[model samples]
Target: MPHFKLNYFDIRGFGEPSRMIFHYAGQDFEDRRWAREQWPEIKPKLVGGKFTGKFTASDTGASPWLEVDGERIYQSVAIARYLGNLFCLAGKDGMENAQIDAMIDSYKDYLNDARAFFWVKSGMGQGNLEELKTKFDEASKRFFTFLQKRIEKVGSGFIASKISWGDFFLADGIKTTMNFDEEFEKKFPKMVEYKNFIFSQPKIKEYIEKRPESVF
Candidate 1:
């Protein structure tokens, strides 16, 4: 097994999926986290002061990058997908794998659209809270509705026919959204159930219980 090191901000924002995959596969890794204050010192060494404000920032200049046997890999999804394939959380065949990738890509699109509302909610940006909330709720309903149908079509406990990276990605995304809304479960019962199914796994549950708390 190669030595694995994951570097990211202390927050779970883009790193938790890979961490969860590590635990699920029983792979030990160095979860190197940096506090916001410490990022300045480390940022120069990692990305050399490149801040694109894009989620798909260059791997060389992004948080949530990974190193395996000292070889670096960039981008959060790239890292998570790599771990997923490494740990056997990927589909068994080419077609299933393509479908899983398609699902993840769709979720990314939804997340990109939702980021504005999340920023305002976190107080990191300014916007009308009520208006954003209304818009987010509408958008979430659409996204979750599509997700629920996908799960039902698969007829498996996970988003795919078998356990795959899509399960972790989609579940974690919904879990994050639910953190801010007390009524989330009521509004999206099926999605909540799906999230619960993935999170209830023994290793995932243990990780979540022991992981450091973050407002995000």
Candidate 2:
């Protein structure tokens, strides 16, 4: 197994899905959480590090990167998908993989809606809070409604017939959204049940119980 060191901010944001993947696979890794004040010092090293393999940092440099035996990898979904393939949580066929990718891309769109409201609530951005909230609520319903139908079509609680990386990604995303709005369970009962089922996995449940709390 590769030695993994996951670097991200103190929040769950883009990093939690990969963390959940590691724990689900019983893979030990370094979960390096950085404070906002420390990123300037930390990011320069990542961009110019003497890593073994290709380094894939963005132009501005970004968090939620992974160091695999000194080879730097970037992009949240890329890192999570790589880890998912390593852990056999990815799809078995190309079509299945495509389906999973499409689901993840759709989820990203929904997440952006949530972030619009979150930035306002956190006072990091300006907007009418109520207006953003209304937009997010509608977006949430659309995404979760599709998710519920997908779960039913697959005839499994997960996005696929068995556990897949999409399940981890979607479940973690919903968990984060729930922090912004706790009424999700009431608004989308079936989707909430799916989230509960995913989190109920022994490894995941344990990680959730011991994981640090974050506002986003």
Candidate 3:
């Protein structure tokens, strides 16, 4: 058995990347998910003195944590990076690693902006749909355009030369954006191609085909 345990809600959200990483690496780990209704009973036990004595984070309330080798690893990005390094999915060299970092940073910025827009427009009462749409349009165009150019330059189906964590990040971003607006592909053809290409990868395709689909 692997010495790793992943704890998160029964959704993709932040835990999806780590789950994908483990799957791609063929690593055996425990995937522990809590249902929404069961959270009341489970939360206290997971966070109480019993479990908390063995696992603790700076913020004990945070979910999507990784417990490995009897050590608690907090923060989603940190967990992803650690797994990436362990599985040799980061890059081959320092410069290549830097490229991965740049790509992940850009992707994170796009996600943050898109998520903000989503939260603001969800209520619809005090939100400005037009303004939020405009903001999303601009951010999406710039980020996807840059990604398209990078993929073209790399001449690989992935963001980096070889498969890396950033590729999954990019794929998830494209999937989320396309989910939000069906017309997203019409707006960005290159991004659409990129998304399809990433999905076509043997491991990724297999992962998607078998993984459970749930709303985050």
Clashing pairs in 3: none
Q: Report lDDT per candidate.
A: 0.82, 0.83, 0.77
Per-residue lDDT over 1-216 for candidate 2, one digit per residue giving the tens place of the 0 to 100 score: 778999888988888899999999999999888777766665544435642222333233677888999888888899989988888998878887888898999999998777889888878889999999999989998988888888899887788768998898898887777777878778887877888999999999999999998877
Lowest lDDT 10-residue stretch of candidate 3: 50-59
Sorted on lDDT, highest at the top, how do the candidates line up? 2, 1, 3
**In candidate 1, which residue pairs clash?**
none
Q: Write the per-residue lDDT of candidate 1 for residues 104-216, one digit (tens) a residue.
A: 88888877767778889888889888888888777787788888888898899786678887788888898889876778899889888899899999999999999998866
TM-score of every model versus the real structure: 0.89, 0.89, 0.83
Error at 71, model 1, angstroms: 0.8
Scored by lDDT, model 1 comes in at 0.82
- Best candidate per lDDT, number? 2
Model 3: CA > 4 A from native: 36-58, 120-126
lDDT of 3 at 168: 72
Off by over 4 Å in 2: 45-60
User: Residue 36 CA error for candidate 1 (Å)?
Assistant: 1.6
